[model samples]
Target: MRIPGPEPRADGGVGAVAAAGGLHRYQLWLHAEYGPVVRFQLPGAETAVSVADPVLLEATAHIDKRPERLFEFLAPLCEAGNLQVLPTAEHTPWRRLLLSVLAGRPSHERHFGQFAALATDLADRWAGQGDREPVALQKDLTTLSLRMIGAYALGGDAADPDKVVTAFEEVLTEHLGRLYQVPVPGTEEERARRAAQALAHLRATVDRVIAAHRSGGRTDRSDLIGALVEAGERPARIRDTVMITMLAAHHTTGVAVSWTLHLLGRHPEVAERVAGELDRVLGERPVPDYADLRRLPYLDMVVKEAMRLYPPGPYGARETTEALVLGDYEVPAGTVIFYPFWAVHMNPDHWPDPEKFVPERFLPEEVAKRPRLAYIPFGIGPRSCEGAGLAMVEAELVLAVLLKRFRFRPAPGHEVTPIERFVLWAADDIHMLVSPRVA
Candidate 1:
């Protein structure tokens, strides 16, 4: 079947996509203009097929191989192997290990108190500031998420949390910001040098943590480092795993909550409902624990709806291993299939007034009316985010704690723009005025 898309410009199809601004924006336009399946060209690959329909995705869901070329940006960070493009034989075991640790409720429960305490520490700081200036919502929240993950995974706080966060940001900005660019000798070499330094700093930090765990300086085999060491994972592999875990777990949860707060800022009514739920459920408790999550359904809906609008990772891709048919389109072996979740989340067919913020849209009855894959903020199938459960728990708890204590309003004149930076993040960072809630 012939796939419809924009005609390739003189520079080529990839150039056309760039002219459309960003990949997410181009995908949205392609789906709107040419229906669910649109074929477009990339630099080295043949025509890539992008499927926007959630139902159509099921046919390709079982294909678990990631596009190696698409993930090469992560190559520098990993020494044991290209962690981002592990062979199926290798990926399965690695993913299974991560799932065993990340998916289990016990791991989350074991660390819930730490997570709550860390979140409260930030809230306490905000209270101290007392609106001296609007909190850099995304910046501070991202730092908090990183700290939570590090403490949970390593079983303690980093020796220098700020340094670690700074290192990670430098590495990501250097590598991810110019993912597909051709190398310029001098400029590229300088970027690589800085990236390498940043990567070294991160690796050093993880190395210290692992060393502590191994020598009995710290003993928490239930934590990720101890668990992996127990499982006999090599030092390099453990370090790589720690780096990747830090990268994956941090910004996504932070961005999700930031966007939710932004939406609630716009809709005071929804904010009131979230505050009400938190007040009734949490009462005198300043933060939530594992059990409290069940009692806060509206807060859950608000987080879910926020994710639907601004999913941490805007899109994911799977390279077709065998010929597959999605709708009327046939995707041949080796074709890269792009799943544009932002577009799917905004698909008008499944969501009425898709752009509007409406938490009730996630109410059980309303959710049941839509297709199962229609709202894939964390993705679907085997390759979906393994931290989905952990992220939700972390997000819901943090939201409950922060909202229960202080109400967030977008600082006047600050505009929040969602941009793809590995994860969807506000362009200049989200700024919110923090105020103490009257009891």
Candidate 2:
């Protein structure tokens, strides 16, 4: 069966769809108009098949090679190799090492204090602002997430956290903004130069952290940098690994929290429930800690539902390694299989009233009724994000802290728009007026 798609444009095929900054919407339209299996083009690949049906996705779940050309923009950030495209043999061990650290509950507990303190700092700042000021949700949360990741993963202060995050933001802004642009904008030349500078600064900072780890004989050898050093990894590998982890780690968690807050702000009743949960769980504490995670089921559901609507990394791609049959269609090896989480989350067949913000949909009882793949804010199968646990813990903790301390309401006249920039992000940023919580 021939997969359907929009008419291919002469200048760039379907590249304009992505470049237009509505790839998610376009994909949804494609599915709605053409059915679950739709074909489209990305800059280098002309025949990418986007599979939205959960049952169909299971057929391609084992295909784990990320589409190389599509991920090339991130190539510059790594040195050991394009971490995203490492072969299964090499990728397996690397992923295992990451899982040992990033997915460990012990590591999260060790770093929980640092994460809570950083979140509380932001809450304190907002509380001090007297409740009426507009808070730039993405900007502040991204910074907070970076700080927490830096402290736990790279040893933030020892790594010059401020400079590292600034350089990273510059690098990402420069590269991600140019992701779909063709014929390269004239102004990108200068931006490219700045991106290079930012990259240099980042490498220098990572090198310094590695050096400190080596020379200090530090007692706190539990951080990611220390674990890497103890494992005898190469300096360049360590640098790239740190950058890659930072690249994946920071934005998703931060963006998740921002979107959750944005959704909660628009849905005051849900916000009230979240706040009530926070209050009941920790009567006087300003933030949720490691142990408090299990006690806040409502907060967990709220975060899960928010992610369903605005997944931080909205889509994932896999290049088929072998021919596979998917829902009556035989897809050949080398086909790019696009798994759009946003589309799956909104599939009317799986989710009733998919666009509505209903945290109850994620309650344990409700969740058990759906297909496992039906709610993968984190991608499914082996290639799913290793830091999923950490991101959730961080997001929930931050949400509890902020909501307990403040009530967020949408600032008048400001619109929040989601765009794909590596991660799904608000184009103008989620702006909200903060006020001290009454209860």
Using TM-score as the measure, which candidate wins? 2
Give all TM-scores, in the order shown. Answer: 0.93, 0.94
Clashes of each: 0, 1
Tell me the tens digit of each residue's lDDT in model 2 across 1-439.
Answer: 8677777778655556756557787778778988888877655677689888987888887766988887888888988888988889988888888788888888888889888888988888888887566989999998998888877767654446787778888887777677745244447678889889999998888788888978987545457887788878899988898888888887889899999999989999989888888888899977777999999998898899999999999898889989988786888999999888999999999899999999999877888898778888889877899889989989988988888888899999999989877789898999999988874
- What TM-score number comes out for model 2? 0.94
What is the lDDT of every predicted structure here?
0.84, 0.84
Off by over 4 Å in 2: 15-21, 157-159, 180-190, 216-222
Report the C-alpha lDDT of model 1 over 117-226, residue by residue, as the tens digit: 99999899999999759989899898899888877766664788778877887787777667745343457778778878989988887888778777874444357887
lDDT over C-alpha atoms for residue 190 of model 2? 84
